[model samples]
Target: MPTSRPNILWISTHDINPHLGCYTGIWPGAEQASTPRLDALAADGLLFEQAFAAAPVCGPSRSAIITGCFPPAIGTMHMRTRATPPPEVRLLPEYFRAAGYWTGNTAFTDFQVDVPEPMYDELGDHTHWRLRDDPEQPFFMAFHSLITHESQIYLSDEEFAARTPDAQRVQKADVPPYHPDTEVYRTSWRRYLELISQMDHWVGTILDQLEEDGLADNTIVVFWSDHGLGMPRGKRWATELGFREPLIVRWPERIAPGSTYAEPVALMDLAPTMLAMCGLDVPGHMHGEVILGPDGRVQGRSEYVVSARDRMGEAEDTSRSIRDRRFRYTRHLHPDRSPMGHTEYPDNLWTWKELRRLFAQEAQQQLAFGEPPSILTDLQRSIVAASKRAPEELYDVRNDPHEEHNLAGLPGYADVQERLDSALDTWLAEVGDLGTRPERDLLARWRPDGRRPRAAEPEVDNRDGLVALTGTTDGSTIGWTTDPPTADRRRWQLYTAPFTPSAPIWVKTWRLGHEPSADVPIAAPAR
Candidate 1:
């Protein structure tokens, strides 16, 4: 390894919990035992057995990871609600960039946070790492994999069959008790496991490339998921399954191989941990503490980790949760609202659709007149009760790992509940959680127009054989796509410098919290 700063490779996958073979001890039967690459990676690194995300959803969770602060505290907790960070805030990559480290990130959904140009030397696909001008410079690269995303579960039957020829279908009896035991639910579970296997292959490819390039030993590879699975009572809930993540860190020169840490840690700590590992100071503004210090030794364990949830898609709600080694406590600010409220994203899931069908069928059975009553099964009734939760909940996680029983009002758990509630109150106050306020109020204060700020049109200048693209909007980043302006945001290229185009293309610009500019056609330069 180089005597100077070590190279950092951060790999993130979408929507998964610690459902690998290693975590089977914690979540028995959750593992499909199919991720050999990740299993091997775990054996060669330090595994964090109790890592959790600051939020259950992607945008808010990633915001916390990048900023080392709670998303709600930084005004970035809501999904698809983009905003520029406050002037006082400094992102993690910006600090690395200032420390002479080259920073880059592959395709990511920055739906809630705006990454300024100075924060990254490269922002595009995985090739950005190779495109760096100085190969010897210490680099911080983040690669995101979307194969395990929730949308993968929405694959058509033919697509699912085509992808999983050898995959084993999970039995309906293996489905968690929280969900109904049905073929639809079983199919969804099996499909998710199949995706996990496929994701492992993609992860293996990156690891193989690092080794083939002879950079594996010098690079500190960190692998983790953004949040939890995108199923009912997950992703948006403040439960253990929603926030817990699988984290593996490998640094052959520093960290001991095949070690495990059981301490409770939040994803926010990653930014500070990376800075500390690179022999840099943890910024005072960062809310997270360094879990791994400069000497590559374990720091003091976090007594508890806190997580929060706000608006998701169109449904608005607020929740805060605190989890210790033995217990998980959650407080829902809007207990009156059902968890089944219309959220467009999750509603697309086949399991969610099946649940909705059952809910509607049960509701129809309860006629107003003297009709013979058709009753819901115990599992269905439990689902309904969970949809409309109590204002406060307390779970003895050690005794009820699945978190099925609520101990908030239970007589023996009063003291436990009070202690956790106090801890949560202190955390909320310290972090300045804005989730306590209404979504509309926050929007009005931040964006009075009730819409994202608009960006100015991009100007294209053709000089000789080169094409230069500029945007009139200050602080906005320019991007171009061969496809239409409304093309997938992931397909657009982050514009940094002028280039000669092989063909005519469309250009657009966007700023955080702003609507993207209309696409402008750029004709190819004539000879």
Candidate 2:
């Protein structure tokens, strides 16, 4: 018999926060979210209790998983992607392609290429794994479920009317106290859960096809979400829900059935592990590491894993985070701005309407009691503002899972706060993150011309403590750090170059016009 390499299937859903029975241990329905497929998949493989996406938002987070690098490291901190991967930066699929595995992406490929115009294939339905059933070739396929996308407009009036109030109650059952308890809010939750059910059905269909093709045993299946639910205190930060993902890794030959690993793991760690499991090189550019030894023993890393968020959708400069399973600490340069919505992006509009109704209800109750309307707490107000965020936030995950408490200034935890802050600061300095706004300003200054160069855009490569900026309006150019930037460099790097799929460009320290640079040879500077 010929030696066989396991085929890989990666399935991702948008904005799901591990609400499935397999991860949350609480399903929406009386029997739990009806997910026979995912439950079966979990039974066959290893389940990761503490897994995180690279970033909390979609575009940037997805990019990090594919490339095994940070969003800022690649100048892709912005949530919406107009940047293309440089020729030198190979995505995971491309690597598999090089290794002779047929690769297919069904739903989304946030990474773009150098084509001058959008390819004719661009308009086709997102890539599907069904295309990868070729028996002659080993394959890698990725599919994303998008019905859970963050938007209140996902429901029809008829659908909302048809749902029983009891059915809708579960949506609000998981609601955090900080948010209002109202029917509008409750109804929104119902719609969202319905979408989750739809996603479950999709998973079932895919699983059936895999079995029919006799690829079930030969394939290593991985199912996860890009981030948490599209709700407040989720998706865009280092909170448990934001980073905690639903991971079902099934490879029966290598992994025993009904196995669960509580050891905290970063999603970035998955890339390296996959490469190692496939018996391929974990490229030098990848910052992630494999958790399991070749002998199949678990070789875990630190007690804590770091999660980062910058700008996304419309959100602006934020900061990196460090969490040690119990506590999360973050440091922000923009103290005045609400960390969440400084660069606001329209979010679940349905939730917004629900909040408005809550506000009205609260006010009416206050008047009926001949009392003043309760003023919103800082945290509650921030949740309602949608775009509001704070420069600094600290939470003890054990006591406050919703991240409602910001303990940055609580006197009792001074020592813990100092330790976390110091650690976070040191990591930023070592990683060459001058700070979000400052880096933005530098990239903008380097690209003075309205247009950025598309062909030679700077990519996230750490070489000699200097990064490069390429594809200037005048052609290939350079940007470098004469001195490593401090917290003052956070500003948006504006350029005229169209942030299109074809004409890629970026802002960084090394100049492409100058002598070429090499990858940063050491691990990122420690905080």
Cα shift from native, residue 334, model 2 (Å): 2.3
Candidate 1 on 58-85: residue-level lDDT in tens? 9899988988888888788988776555
Q: For each candidate, give its TM-score against the true structure.
A: 0.83, 0.74
Error of 2 at 186 (Å): 0.9
Model 1: how far is 493 from its true place, Å?
Answer: 16
**Model 1: residues with Cα > 4 Å off, grouped in runs:** 126-128, 161-173, 364-380, 384-387, 448-527
Expressed as tens digits, the lDDT of each residue in 364-481 for candidate 2 is 7677786665654555566554343566678887677667788888898888888888876665565444226454464564345534432334445444533333443332223222
Best by lDDT, which number?
A: 1
